[model samples]
Target: MAASLTAFAAAASADTLFGAMEKAYVTNPTLNAARAGQRATDELVPQALSGWRPTVGVGGEVEALISTQRAVVPEADELVDAVINDEAVSGNLAIELTQPLFNGFRTVEGTKAAEARVDAGRQSLLETEQQVLFNVVQAYMDVYAFRQIVVLRKQDVAALEEQVRASNERFAVGEITRTDVAQSEARLAESKSALVDSQTNLARAVAKYIQTVGNEPGKLVYPKVVNLPKSMQMALDAAGEINPRLLAQAFVEVAANSDIGVARSGLLPSAGLLAGGQVSDPDFTEDQNENASAVFGASFSIPLYEAGLVYSQVREAKQRASQSRIQVIEIARDVRRAVVESWNAYVGLGEIIKNTRTQVSAAQLALTGVQQEYAAGTRTTLDVLDAQRELVFSQVLQVTAEKNRVVAGYQLLAAIGHLTAPRVGLKVPEYNPEENYQRVRNKWIGTSVETVE
Candidate 1:
């Protein structure tokens, strides 16, 4: 187990988005907790089966006694029948068995309810896995986006500093007013402050990423480009059908419906067969005889009244089933809203990125022209400084637009429920409750954790 965890940690540090998602899929505490709860639900299956299977038990007892007896008679014929001091010991043993004959289908309904619970639990786990994967993707993209901003901010600061230097030269040569030099210096300081703010954002993103993935992301790689579906309606349609939250809600409704059957079964009679044998000895003697006997009998329990408890329970189950159905409709509406909101945000950012790219190209060309003119003494140093500042601003906008585009894509995927273990390229571990339950359910037991290779 240690080796496997170590390998997972290493893999988690390899990429910015995918790696964190994969690690969280296996190692996140919340997801593990959900899995544990689901396994607990699985035990109900065997518990329900018990109502149909035979129960057997063995028991033995031993006793010892010492006594003296005296008799008194009212007439002359009465005499001491005997006078004695004796020690006696006895032992008794028996095995008993009970099997269900009829149970008004209570056992069958219980089993069906248990199976429905198992299904609900499995869906809940899948929903939890989807949530964890979404969190990892968001954090990873946050780090990537902020890091890119930090780089662009640094470049902006550098460009502003060069602009300030050019303004100072022009002021010395009397080619431009001192006001231009002061404006340039003020802008440079603002650029420095922006760089500091960008660095702080980047640090926070990295910290969040580390917390989620359980390791620092080292030498991060760009996330693979995920192609959006052809249209927003297509994405919404796909999401409405496959979303884990919706699926989980559907299963909850199923479990609630099954509960109604279980509650109804409680109103009927139950029947079972029972058998037992026993042997007893009055005293421990040189010659001992063993006696054995067997008998089979059927028992029934009729439910006459329970102060309306069964009826109340049935009413409650029906109400819960109705509530579950309403929840499914609510979840579907919420999912649709999320799909539309995320899709719009993604498309808006894409447009900004495209426009910013064009602005950067225009600013770069303008800066080139200003540089040539300044070198030939045809333009003042202030002109060159202004052109360079515009170029730096354009570069910053382009970087921000790119980051926004990527982060929006992640959000869109999360909204659609596609951000889950298998969808995000993470392996899901298999869990078997029966195997673990059999190991500890019926025996005197202790537990220890051991590493699995």
Candidate 2:
């Protein structure tokens, strides 16, 4: 099944937008790094839950004592004294356990904060995915458009070459001045230089395409115009609700609020259960003695003061929550602005594309008429050169306008947070952030993690 899917994907990569997007979704390092970051974030819940679990510790100690002492004894009214040496060894082994029963609701609030942060991290991952896809779109269009421009420039160079040859022939026959031939030669050189510039741009575009899409671009198919919202107001409304950055910031604000709760919890009392067992062996004179004991009890603790540390922490958390709320408002404003700008660009490019197409058609006819007139000695050589230049400029404009139109449409979609792999109908499997979160949220003990890859 995997082989068949790979074959199908290979077949679909012949000049397609969805193919590039799908490849980027599966293989782009930027997207994959974001995925890994989010997966790491999934461990936060387990970390929080560990607060409710028991902690166990085991230890042993051995010690040897040596000393010299003077001993005195009284026997029937007579005193006696002697020097003595002493040596002793002792050993002890113990195990202890503690289980949290309560912690001033710190654990509860901490768990809530961790969960909120996980939510925020998921949104952040989505935002990263959106950006990766948007970059792919722009890079793809750039390669396609610049590649076409290079072709047009090559054609222009060929036409100018022909003009130079014709002018040399006329000069040889005394029908045109040397100045005309030189002019044609200069124009040909300029056109060739322009071709080189176009080639350079194409090279840069190809590099970007490879970086974003994780593959060298193939011959790209002409992209279809994207479907947009009916009006600018609709686009703005959609962006306001769905823009990933804005949503992520809103989640961050919630997490920050939860942080305040977690900080406040530090001021309250805590309760736990403690249990232990110990065994010890000691040597006394000629006899060995051993002792063992078991202990279990409930424990409670209250915080009275900490040099105002907890209070300051609570204050800091409140300030951060306020900052987060303000950030949400700022992101909303930026999203609205992006929607407006992208909408205008998308709309404006449509008219420019239409106009440039008409210009190309008219320029082609004008150039042909001017060349014919020059051949008949009814026009100057300069007129024919001007007409050819105009035609080439129009062609360049047309290609650029088409490229901008397509790119602007994609930008509008991105601004509205609709440029997702699923929405674009990419054929690759999608990564589910929640799946990893669910798998590890309550996990008790483990080093290995379940991953999408």
Candidate 3:
């Protein structure tokens, strides 16, 4: 199955937008890095969950003591040494446990905050995916347009070369001045230079295509027409509701607000249950034996004063929450602005594309008439050269306008948060960041980072 998929991908990437987008979806380094960052975020849930679970630990200690002893007989007048030296060894091994009963609902609020952050992280990953896809779209369009422009430049150079030859023939026969021939030659030189520049642009575009799509493009197929919102208001509405960055910011605000609760918990009382069992040998004396004991207790603490640290932390959290709330408003306004700008640009390019096509058609007709007039000696060499230049210029504009229209449409889609892999109809698996979050959210132990591909 993998081999077949690989073969299919190779064939598609050789000449299509879908293949390029699919390849970037699976292999782009930036997208993969963002996924990894999201997985790191998913671990926060498990860390928060640990607050509600008991902690168990095993420990052991060994000690040795040395001493010198002396005694005085009560009936005797002199003191005598009763013991020269004494040594004793003691060891203890224990297992201890603590389970939280309450801590002013800190765990509850912390878990809520963590879950909210994970939600925000998922949205952030979506935003990153959209960015990568949009970059691919722009890069692909640039290379395609430049490649077409290069072809036009080559055709222009060829036409100018023919014009120069004709001008030279006319001058040799005394039908035109040397100036006409020189003019044609100069125009040919300019066209050649333009051809070189076009080729350079094509090369640069190829390099960028490789970087963004993870493969060198073959003969690329133009991207399919995107589904656009019906009106500016509709686009704005979609962006307001679904724009990934805006949604992510909203989630961050929720997380920040939850943190206030977490911080306030520090000022309240806490309680926990503690239990332990120990096996010990207290001394090495012959009459001594090992002993075992068990202990169980509950602990409670009330906050007195700690230099006002908890109060300060609570204040800081509230301020941060306020900052986040402001950011949500800021992001919403930014989204609206982007939607408006992208909508206008895309709509304007539609008319531009139509106008450029009409210009190309008229230029082609004019060039044909000018060339016939030149053959009949009714039009000068200069007139023919001008017509050819106009035709090529119009043709170049047509190609560029088409490319820009497509790119502008893509940009508008991106602005409205609709340029997703599945939404755009790329034949690839969608990345589900939530799968990783669910996989690790309640884990208690071990360190395995393997998540869904």
Instruction: Kindly list the per-residue Cα lDDT of model 3 for residues 227-251, writing each as its tens digit.
Output: 7899999999999998999999999
Q: Is candidate 1 or candidate 2 better by TM-score?
A: 2
Candidate 3 Cα errors over 4 Å, as ranges: 1-14, 64-87, 284-287, 376-380, 451-453
lDDT per residue as tens, model 1, 1-453: 999999788766667566567677777787778777766776677777777788899999998888887655445776546566778788888889999877767777777777777776776777777677766766777677677777877887787788778777878998778887887888788878888998998888888877777887675656754756779998898888877777778877887787888888788888888998887666658455656677778788999997999999999999999999999999899988988988998899889988888999999999999889877878766687678778777877887677667767766777777766556555555444345445533433244422222
Which wins on lDDT, candidate 1 or candidate 3?
3
Error of 1 at 93 (Å): 3.0
Error of 3 at 321 (Å): 1.5
Go through the candidates in order and give each one's C-alpha lDDT: 0.76, 0.87, 0.88
Against the hidden true structure, what lDDT does model 3 obtain? 0.88
What are the per-model C-alpha RMSD values against the true structure?
7.3, 4.8, 5.0
Order of candidate numbers by lDDT, starting with the best = 3, 2, 1
Question: In model 3, what lDDT does residue 225 have?
Answer: 53
Task: Choose 1 or 2, whichever is better by lDDT.
Answer: 2
Q: Where is model 2 more than 4 Å wrong at Cα?
A: 1-13, 66-87, 225-227, 283-288, 451-453
Residues 1-453 of candidate 2 have per-residue lDDT tens digits of: 999998778766666887788888998898898889899988888898888999999999988899999979787898889778989988889999999998877778778878878888887887888788888888888888888888898999999999999899989999999999988999999999999999999899889999998878886877774557899999988888878888888888888888898898889888999999998887534344888999999999889997899999999999999999999999999999989999999989999989999999999999989988998999998898899999989999999998888888888888898888777667888788888888888887788876545
TM-score for all predictions?
0.76, 0.90, 0.89
Candidate 2 weakest lDDT stretch, 10 residues:
281-290
